[model samples]
Target: MASFRVKGGLKLKGEIIPQGAKNEALQVICAVLLSPEDITIDKIPDIRDVNKLIELLSDMGVTVRKNGPESYTFNAAAIDLDFLETQDFLDKASALRGSVMILGPLLARFGTGKLSKPGGDKIGRRRMDTHFTGFQKLGATFRYDKKKEIYHIDGSDLRGCYMLLDEASVTGTANIIMAAVMAKGKTTIYNAACEPYIQQLCGMLNRMGAKISGVGSNLLQIEGVGYLAGTTHTLLPDMIEIGSFIGLAAMTQSEITIKQVQADKLGIIPEIFRRMGIKLDIIGDDIHVPSQKHYEIETFIDGSILTIADAIWPGFTPDLLSIVLVTATQAKGTVLVHQKMFESRLFFVDKLIDMGAQIILCDPHRATVIGLDRKYPLRGIRMTSPDIRAGVALLIAAMSAEGTSVIDNVEQIDRGYQFIDKRLNALGASIERID
Candidate 1:
């Protein structure tokens, strides 16, 4: 196992480029299975999750070749559906949440799919009922083997149908769209996730000859086509990573510029950060965080304490709530953070509290953070990463703390951020990789 030893109290300076969106890349790679020709994807992140998904695809007989750094050519014309039932495939599929996306394309093209229970951060119970319910609406039958923890889906000639999902799940929305794209008729999905990742999936499918409307709205309409052609696509920049960088700059009192940031795609993120008294300058496609003069939490309209929370697309992302919470610890005032989507995500505040942060965990979904305002910067301390978002949050806290801090089980962080230590080092962050 590898770990990160960071000496905090150093300001990060210079420019850093954000990596490709990991969530979007995973869905896009699986979409390749819908086409017979070669599909090339550029700007793919070199992270463990992406690597694991690629390995699963290769095991299914998809031809995945590295064309260049962060580029790949995939041909799923020879995919073997039988491989989906193997023990090796089950083990890998159960390791990442993104693996559930392959179910739609596999079922669409081959009429059946067998998958294990998908795994990811243990923040909450992310049910697949929405996914299966949507599939059932389109003429798919599901059989569950509780003892073996396997899901068997069987369908013939999926016909388009209107589906109203219980919630706006990002991966679940992507899966429904993939299955609907090759169905027999028109399919309408309500309460669909319209995040940038979902938008990118729709755009990529459109380029490959699938007709999908309402790209950035909660309602999606997909016109079924007999076949989709192979196409080349590039992924959007990782908004989560971009948010992390913003928090990093704020906490460390650094002035760093991010290149190629899709400013418009980051809906309400900058404005939310602005509420924390963090000023950002957007020069064209770049985001510049100037050196901090002061960090103060702005009050709400009624002069009440501001509360920041996460929601579906066009709202703040749940994935970045941890980073936001950590950044707020160094601000000048108090803010309420509500993480309604996940229960265990807010539990990581215990580590920050140990580092001299003033936080009150009100419940599983809420916390009150009183900032130290640079008067008492966090003291360096050792901690273990429990999950991906928490790992990044702890890293940001460690970077802004005094002295040295060690973060163990860094592989969790590696699953999301690509070359995090190297990228932060380029911006003058004193973080070293240790084994």
Candidate 2:
């Protein structure tokens, strides 16, 4: 059990480089299993989730080599299929939701796959039906072992087919694509997620001999190939971390530059922060946010209070809603933080309220925040991080408060952000990790 002791009221300065995307790394690493050849990946974020997946791969007999601090070479040429049926593999698979992605690659290369009920943050009901349904659509026979809580999928006779997904599930879309790429014929997926990560995965698959089109659209087409070749891939910057940095600068009145953001891919994130009256400069690929004594939240064109809500890609991301909520606490006006995707994410607002933030927890999905406008500084207090996003939000609040605050169960934070305390400390913020 680790904890973070954050000293508040310090203005951070200097530049901080964002790590490679955690979400993308998880998918790309699992995709390595689709080929018998070696695949080299760069810009891999050093975080808990990714390391856990890599450990799982190593345990399954994949040859994982460290090319550099942020690079690796994975050769799945001699994977042990028998390991999938063991209790150790099941327990490891159940530790993170990203482990579910390995099923698609395993089924694609070996004709069979097994998955335990995936585990992740307790934010909402994340159903795996979409992933299973997509597999079944591609001619894979799927079944659930009720007593063991395992899903079994066989892809020995898989053939490409049409699938209209119920929603734009990101992981589900990636999983199905990995499975469909090696099927017998053409496969078309409608209502597919078009996030940058998905596009990158599609591009990588194409480079590795898979035929996939419609890179940035809701409809994707794939022509099955016999086997994929090993190829190198570099992950995109972590957009979620960029959003968190933006909110951190605003809440703490800091002048921080976030480096290597690749601005165009950020979509609506910068604008969402600007709507909260946070001034940001897009200097090349870096985001420079200057110190602010006061900032105001904007209203709608019809004079209604602004509302920040999450949606699929091209819309606000649900991962940063907690950051936006905590950032709005010090802004001039009020904004409604609506977390439409997750039910339990907003429950952490109670900790912010105890820290002197003015937030009304309307329900599981929405909260109305009345900005304190810097009239009264938040008082630091102790808290437990419930999930990854909420954990980061609590850290932001603690950093902007009036005294030292301790955040326990910080493993939740480590799972996503890499060396968060050290990185922020380099910019002059005081965050100490306590074991």
Candidate 3:
């Protein structure tokens, strides 16, 4: 277990570039299996989950080559179908939630896909019904082994059909799109997830010979093609990480510039921070957050308490709710953070309460933060990270708190952010990684 010894109350300065989008990286990397041709991806973040997926592909006989520090060329022409039955595959696939995505491409191209029950952040019950349900709609046979906790799907003669999704799940939509691209007929998907990452995947698929329309809308149409060719794709900057940096700047009263943020794709993230009283300027593609001693939360036009909730894209992202909750601690006035997607994400508030933030755990789904206005600064304390988002939130809290704080299980943070400590240290924050 790795821990971070963070010295609190240091104001960070200079610029930080957000890494490649982790969510998009997971989806696109899995898409490489859709074609046997060479697929080169640039801006691949060097994080644990993405690296694990790459390794999984390599173990399955996909030839992978490093083109640069953050570039890779993958050729999946010689995949070993039998490897899916191995215990090694079972163990590895069971550990990553993203591994479930490989199912669509494998079933589409090779007619069969096998996977163990996937694991990821212990936030709540992340159901796979959407994925399997979409597959079944596309003429795939689905089976689950309760005893082994494994999933099996067969798409020997996949025929596309129109379907309305139960939820606009990003991964679910991506999986179904990948499968339908090579099906026998046209597939129309209503209520599809239209996030930027999903659009990127759809665009890349189109560039690779897929007949997809409605790239940035809730409705998607796909015409089955005989084959797909490989193409080079570059991932967008992680919006979640950019949001985190914005919160970090405000919490510590730092002047930090986040560069090449792809501002248009951020979708209300900047406005969400502005509502929290953080002053941020969008200069070209960079977000410049100036130093602030005090920022006040905004109320609704009707003068009601401001509530920040997560919904599907175009709404605020649920991934940054933890950062919002932590950032609201030192601001003026109050805000309610409603984490609609995950039930257990708000449980980390107790740790922030321990650090002197006035937060009411309204329930499993909501938290109300009464800002201290920086009058009562948080005091550092030893704590353990429960998940990636909460871990980074706690690190932000500790950075703005008085004295030093020790955060255990920093591997959670490492899974998302690349060289976080070193990057923040360059901007004048004091953080030491202890093994």
Top lDDT hit:
3
Candidate 1, residues 216-266: lDDT per residue as tens digits? Answer: 999999999989999999999999999999999999999999999989899
Cand. 3 TM to true fold: 0.99
User: What does the lDDT read for residue 326 in candidate 1?
Assistant: 98
Candidates ranked by lDDT: 3, 2, 1
Candidate 3 runs further than 4 Å off? none
Error of 3 at 92 (Å): 0.4
Q: How far does residue 305 in candidate 3 sit from its true spot (Å)?
A: 0.6
Candidate 1 global Cα RMSD: 0.9
Give each model's whole-structure lDDT. Answer: 0.92, 0.94, 0.96
Candidate 3 lDDT by residue in tens digits, 64-170: 99999999999999999999999999999998999999988998899899999999999999999889999999999978899999888889988989999999999
Work out the TM-score per prediction.
0.99, 0.99, 0.99
**Candidate 1 to truth, TM:** 0.99
Candidate 2, lDDT over the whole model: 0.94
